[model samples]
Target: SKFRQADFNLDPLWQIRFDRPLGYFAEILSTIGILGFLAYLILVLVALNKAMILKTEILIFPLLAMLIGQAYYYQNTTSSFIFWFWLAMIAGLCSKIKENKISFILNKETLRGRIMAFVGIIVISLISLFGIFFISRVCFADYFYKQSSKKSVGEEKIVLLKKAILINPYFSGYYITLSQAFLNNALSESQKPVKDNQKIFKLVVEATNSANKATQLSPNWVMTWQTLGMIYQEVLGLVVGVEDWGIKSFEKAIALEPTNPVFYSKLGKIYFAKHELDKAKEQFIKARALKPDFSELQFFMSLIKEEQGDIKGAIKSLERLQVFYPLDLDIIFQLGRLYFNQGETDKAIIQFQNVLEINPNHLDGLYSMALALEKKGDRAEALAYIKKALALSPENQILEKKFEDLKN
Candidate 1:
């Protein structure tokens, strides 16, 4: 009964024949278009029926094309399996078509006709072989490209991507992915001991070359420029003009996609690092206007407020953030510390207790709570809290000394 209903919509699943009026009309039009195409293909096959003895084999081409197109459009595993199964059927059908056609020509036609038919079969076979080879190469390249994403090791992913590039040299995405893998490897190598500066240099060079190749291949792609900019900014270190290159790249990305808050945020951070605080604040404000609820923007705003000697404004901003991310321990800890600095001991103690409730082993929370207790004239409770903190971090010389002093 459910299946029989007309407007029974199930999102991200099947849309059957009678789903909606528009869908019904769309299906009718598609069916008509397909049937018309098939009719035209049948007529073409019929015209070649005299020379081509295997009419069924000739007809199968359009059917296979239709099946493959449908499979690609639906993008489901079952449809893919059906497409492959039909592909297998085409192989057997091709052999049967060739054998039957040859036999028919030898039995019914003259020797000259038989010879011509054999020659035609050879030409067709060559074309079919070339088509199969090309399709197989493309399919294998796509498979390897997909595999590269699931791999964790950068070298292994690079190998897979290289294989894909060898098969599909024209695809810009393969080069881009390869570039990213090289950049990751370079960053990882940089963190290790400086025993091989040449090796790190080589990795960085490779990353730059691959990224340059990607940009050349797709000059208009915003993501390619963004990736190149990030590589220049982060991997190459902030050399004299490197930050300018990064800024220009982000500017290009923003020009192409003006409404994207992420691009604005990145540009703001670059300005922030350059200590151009006024320019940074303007970009940050624009980004905040685009994405009002962005937590990172709020955090950055609080930092800017603190930098400008507006401690109360900073505290108020963090308190507003607490309403959005109440359970975030980092925000709670920072808020508690801010309150403590402002001599709001009772509020600071409450926040410290909340932190300890969330994570009982938080050393900073315990130490701060002890200090708040001492300030409240509850020396016994202060000593108990300090003892707990000392037990947790027994190797801390400072905490051990504080514990001894409190015991006295």
Candidate 2:
């Protein structure tokens, strides 16, 4: 009775609020448990069958990557987490296979063993390759890959990958993979100012050549073009006077994959930087058409439109952006300004209110809200808001003038 009574002092609502985090944790643990069980069952079955049939089976690195990847994906589902998880799973599988584990499992000799063993191997290989493809896509999109510098570990990976490619160099992926390693190294080295540009430049050219080879090997591979384009763009940005070359590279990528929103969006940025508003808008609109849900593209379009003196068009684009990312502070602030520019005080006030609700300390929101109140003849409320704005931005002369005017 005493023990039970002692356990009853917790607040139920506090416990309920705590449950949400616990629930997420439990979900992650449950997923991991299920994957681990599956691995155990599969490995055990393969080992037992090998023992019985006097043969070993290959451990499917790809399948393991997939299983672990799916588990991790469901665990956090973020790109970075997924990247590291997939990376680890792939490297682990490759390491295991390099140690002859895959062959050990697949070499099993049994009437029933051969069928299921090959099936398992095929399934696993597919998942691993898929993981590699997924990782490659991310690398193309972000233009970076993170690899550890532990010589033994990373060398093992490189060696294992080389071995895999040797077994099948006809696959375009082998070239992509080799390119990724170089690209990753180039990226890491590029960040270190002390690192020699000549060395980095050599690596970049090699990476570009490899990526181009991959594209040549598989012309239909959309990812290859993208990667090659990114390499050109990033490396050229570092070495000045390569804008013409960079534009050509982007054009090649666009030609290869015209429908990719990211490709168009990136090209649009390049065009915008070149002061080619019409060309920039063309690419941005194409990107918007392809992926309407891409809020950032709309924002870019808005910026271009505003630069071109199309305030109404800019406002429309911002409105569209607000729908997808309502709490984006920049979007909210921009929408407010756009409305204010058009002399629509009521609409501007609503937009400012939204910003203040999301971020009470927002300087622009506070100042605008105060002005809107003053315009409506609510002197007392307006003055109070002005004081609040001034409190947030004591150095602002505009707020000081408004505050003094209100007092007068």
Top candidate on TM-score is 1
Candidate 2 lDDT, 1-408, residue by residue in tens = 101121222323211112122333245455578677566556634544443353222334433444454443433436446444544443444343443545545556765558778899899999999977865665443322123222332334445445545545556766676667677777777655256678778777777777888888887566677677777667656666545555666677666545456677877877776778999889888877766666778788788889889899899878878888988988988888888778888898899889989989887788888877787778888898888887766666888899999999
Displacement of residue 380 (Cα, Å) in model 1 is: 19
Report residue 76 deviation for candidate 1 (angstroms).
12
Off by over 4 Å in 1: 1-137, 186-205, 230-241, 327-408
Give the least accurate 10-residue stretch of model 2, judged by summed lDDT. Answer: 13-22
Off by over 4 Å in 2: 1-169, 193-196, 241-258, 306-323, 326-408
Q: Against the true structure, what is every candidate's RMSD?
A: 10.5, 18.2
* Each model's lDDT: 0.73, 0.67
Model 2 reaches what TM-score against the true structure?
0.39
